[model samples]
Target: MSQTDVAQANPATRDAEVLIVGGGLSGALLAAQLLRLPGRRRILVVESRSELGRGEAYSTVELGHTLNGNAARMSVDPDNPDDLTHWLTQHIAAGGWPESDRQHLPVSQLFAPRGLFGVYVQQRLAEAREQGRARGSSVTHVQGEAVDLEIDRDGARLSLADGRQLRGAVAVLATGMFPAARTPQTRSSGLNAAALDPWDVAAMAALDPQARVLIIGSGLTMVDAVVSLEQAGHRGPIEVFSRHGLLPHVRRQPPAWEDFLAADLSIRRPRQLLRALRQQCHAAQAQGIDWQAPLDTVRVHIGRLWSQATDVQRRQFVRHVRPWWESHHHRSPPLSAELVARLHGQGRLRIHAGSYQGLEPSEDGGLAIRLRYRGSQESVRLAGDALINSSGIEYDWRRVARPFPRQLLARGLVTPGPLALGISAAADGAVYDARGQASARLFALGPPLRGMWWESTAVTDVALQAKALAARLAALPL
Candidate 1:
């Protein structure tokens, strides 16, 4: 048999210089950067979704699910900061936007719809693939879920759900955010199939117009639920419940403030850092500047701060300060903020601070929810037509029911990270095995790196990580 015969014999085994699982923003951007580097190689990106860049977050068909950040700040290219803005301008021009309407569109600062942003990402990836092909490199996008990874000394074998095996020099796990996991209380509760996914616009709209909705989280996801409901013309009252009852602050483009915390090494502990941050915020407020200025400065050094934290400090931060930090740091888009405010003012939305006890069947063919009020020991009961689990991404790996991750844990290909936030991996993206040793053939990026970088989910952060990972992979002996 000749080489061609052998190739035909092993039809299931596809070869690639690099194999990336989960072709969301992280994998797609990494493929783009790697193809642009000074070498030509074959890159394979496997995604379950039909679209390359749009995972669950951006693939929504609802136009009302807009991006949380502005186009100027959400570019996929770190080197070209205004790439998305420029792309949007060209896109609008190509779409034949009237000249009078062009000025009204703020490509730089406006929050584009999430679906449109997904298109922008897909377009960029397509361009990158074209560039790679022009330079003797190649990119292949396969629509499938990667179920398992088999590792050896030379490389790793990826098993897809459709019984396909891909052999590559290295494998990268870019599995994006997981769906919200119900708490133990929710599991034991009799309300089965009662919790609706916040992103299910059709199902949410199918509810009765006067049905009361109980949202189980007050973070950005809850905000998204609100936007979807309003778009579907839902006139029912919306109730948001969370332990802290803190809502995301509205996004703003503030002037760059001095990064005072970058040089403050003494603030190593979470308590010390929080105190210092408060002082900075107060000083900025006293000077008639928004507290966001000081918080923006902290973003510059957040990675370093998170990396330097001790295990105890990290745990303490999660237990005591995570809620406040998330609400303040990850803000809602301007349009979303305005809509939520108007709804609240109109008495259509209400937020409560409490703990969800359980759910019981209501007399009116709905669900009755029990909650322990924030300030009182007495429980409160609320009746609603529907409940939604908008509690955001469940970070704890032990709790997630995803099959691939569970398999990885059972085989000891990866270990849980600190605080069980995500998979354990080095800062350089080399994944650790059951024995806590880094593997050369296996790597990870994006949300799975939350343990290493607390703020790894943002596009900007993922872009930076992709660039660095591409550079490091380029230097590796392939």
Candidate 2:
């Protein structure tokens, strides 16, 4: 069916058994799983954006923006472990790529483009709709922003920005990550045109190639913006600013299996876990394997460790080790890493490690950014024609100025987690209110719940959460 016809159907205007607020990867996966259930249960997904499958993270048009992890590790299907690998092979075949080149690379080392992954997800959703399953418990995609949610004795009422209301027996808040927070100096000085949000495609496309660009943060988002500039044919010099100025390490193919971490090893404390990981790294190196293999072993246990950690331990991890951990754990794809290397080799990309002090208007309508470097009491300055806020999602819930979450917290319907990183949620994905009561009807399953679960961003971790949430929603009394 045409997209216009689907919009005209308006099945989401009616009541539904399950109402999903976000149509990102988690929501789409959960919707697909719900359709597989035996009994009938209506599933309506309300997405603020026009596209259903491509959320902010996966919506890039640039082919250089590939998945950080390998294809073999990412799959929505828990039962079919090689689902993404099979999809990659089919995709390459359809694209007429040489089979000789495809067969040599390990499935675990293949890095697919983000857009291709989005297309794969859309295809899966389409296949689910083709079967008779979607007809009974239909998956309706609505294009509207959910502004307010009213939870009362008679289920939940969702208020959209366009004055429409959606009633559902159960509502899931899978609203992914919060948008990057803007600095006050940029806002008050009328420098909005100079400072761009990385996700704002329209603004990015309007940038002039001659203009000098300054990216705010030096992480995955910065890598994405740099890649987007190159893909868009921009040739201007780019400067990346961050507290540590540390770029993501490149991901490489893993070597033969090494015995470092036992499958059943359970270390909850941050200090103890770090010590054990360091020891494992040395052991793996002596056995002719890189330390990263053992770290990958630790990644499998991160969720369990986070759940068992005390508040003090969690704070210790965040305060003392999160920066180093993030840079190493979230490695860049080989293509992106090569691009950065080339840019640095050509002297077009400059990275600065410092804390942003402020920004001032230059004489020629450009921006002069002030920053304080490490071990320096004095401030330094850099001039740029345009600046991009490529910092990843702001985890502080209190800093989020959006109306939906602000209203929810004001009404005691939601509460921030122990460290105020994001919304509090139980281990089963059920959201906890201010009274510390888990609402069986409301659940959050994504990076927004990072305060409660530290390892919730990657595709594999989120897929597991989606599966667990799908089971819970399926078992709900309707």
Candidate 3:
């Protein structure tokens, strides 16, 4: 008589055309695309949060945590490249944006607070839902966490946290990024001293303004933390350390350049691609153009090139090239970059190339952090009132303590991605078992597909994948 009993008794009666887990950008965009299909279809989106489309990255309400790019570059729809720009213009016209916030910048190039973008995504999803209704389709949003997945002959059944079960003809894992799993070094230390969330405004505000602060990563997340400290009127010295300590480059408008890599599908290897990219960077610099223009050329071809790479070559890139590639490709916004530079100039911020060794309780009831410098193994000690982990999300699902991923691995529903970077799946997002056989009713998108597509994080890439997956799932017999 319960939902679980009903789901097990009559799977088809409980089934939807597609069941999308996570309800984040990947799921929402896929739903949007599914609604555009010619035939009637049902999409059921399951989310842990009450709202849909915000995901973890855009879920922050803090003003200091802003998107890394301008409004024009963040649209969920690739066909409408300037959709966000147009939306912002309309939003500004309707007095949606604050007047004080509007005066200093161009709307097209503005790096608005991430919460505003979340609202935009929600609005877009609502519109798509209505559009689906007009086209004899339906999208239902369910609130709960899917703790386990069971594949049956009929389809797949998802067990929710509240003891409810839902069935769908097919399922897509749009689970995005998971929080970093605590390493052995981080685990032994007192969490109060070192393991603070990077996005907690209250925690950052509680820090003593004059006390030293230590941050564990030198990327965009660290930029957000610095901005939060400054906004809270903290005048303390800050230390940022990472494996390479390579900070993201500041974003800038660049002149268009020829897509030199576009025509060259022959450069399939990572080393060859790196060499070609370096040549392009040098040529662009010689022409007084930013090297990013050349780098962007490789973005579209990444999935193809990555698929062609051998496992050993993929491992080589992960070990040797990933850090520099991330720093070069994932640049920070102009405003945040300027703030970081200003802090460094004032001698209030210092960046070190090193790896965290351990954390110890200091004499002053603070954290004594140990690190090994990049080139040498000598340990260095530093003390701070608090340490925040800004090292970003952990992509390897095996390490995370989440229940659903563990269930999938145990049931042989999914495998670790190529090089153990993300959830392993086929190039088109079909879920694969440990034996490397693809599933007919299970799929994935977004960050979980990073193993197949190296450049899977950006909105542009997610949008393309969502569109493709939607079309593929839509055409399948229900």
Each candidate's clash count: 0, 0, 0
Please tell me which model should have the higher lDDT, number 1 or number 2. 1
Q: Could you tell me every candidate's TM-score relative to the true structure? A: 0.92, 0.90, 0.93
Query: How close is each model in CA RMSD to the real structure?
Result: 4.4, 5.7, 3.7
Candidate 1 clashing pairs?
A: none
Q: Show pairs that collide, candidate 2.
A: none
Per-residue CA lDDT of model 3 for 85-138, tens digit only, reads 888888988988674273377787888788888888889888988888998999
- Stretches off by above 4 angstroms in model 2 are 1-14, 96-108, 131-135, 181-193, 199-210, 256-266
What is candidate 2's lDDT per residue for 1-478, written digit by digit as tens? 1223222433454488778989988778778777776678788899987877677677766567778878877886777868888877777777633432532566556777787788888887777655526457678898898888876545667888899898886789878776473422212333334577664555666778767888878888888778877776678889888888898888876664544445546565888888988988888889888878888877767777887888988888888888789888888887788898899889899888888777865797777888888778999888887788777777766666677777778878789976887789888888898898887567888876888778777777777888888888777665
Query: Model 1, range 1-478, lDDT digits (tens) per residue?
Result: 1223222323234498789998888888899889888778788899988778888778887767788888888899998989988987887778722331422546787677888888888888888888888888888888887888887655778888899888887788888777573332323354326787787778877888878999888999998988888877789899999999999999887777778776677777778888988998899889888898888878757778898999988988999899999999999987788888899999999999998888865787778889997998999888888888888886666666666787788889999988888899988899999998887778888888898889889999999999999988777656
What shift in Å separates residue 237 of candidate 2 from its native position after superposition? Answer: 2.9
C-alpha lDDT (0 to 100) for residue 151 of candidate 2: 68
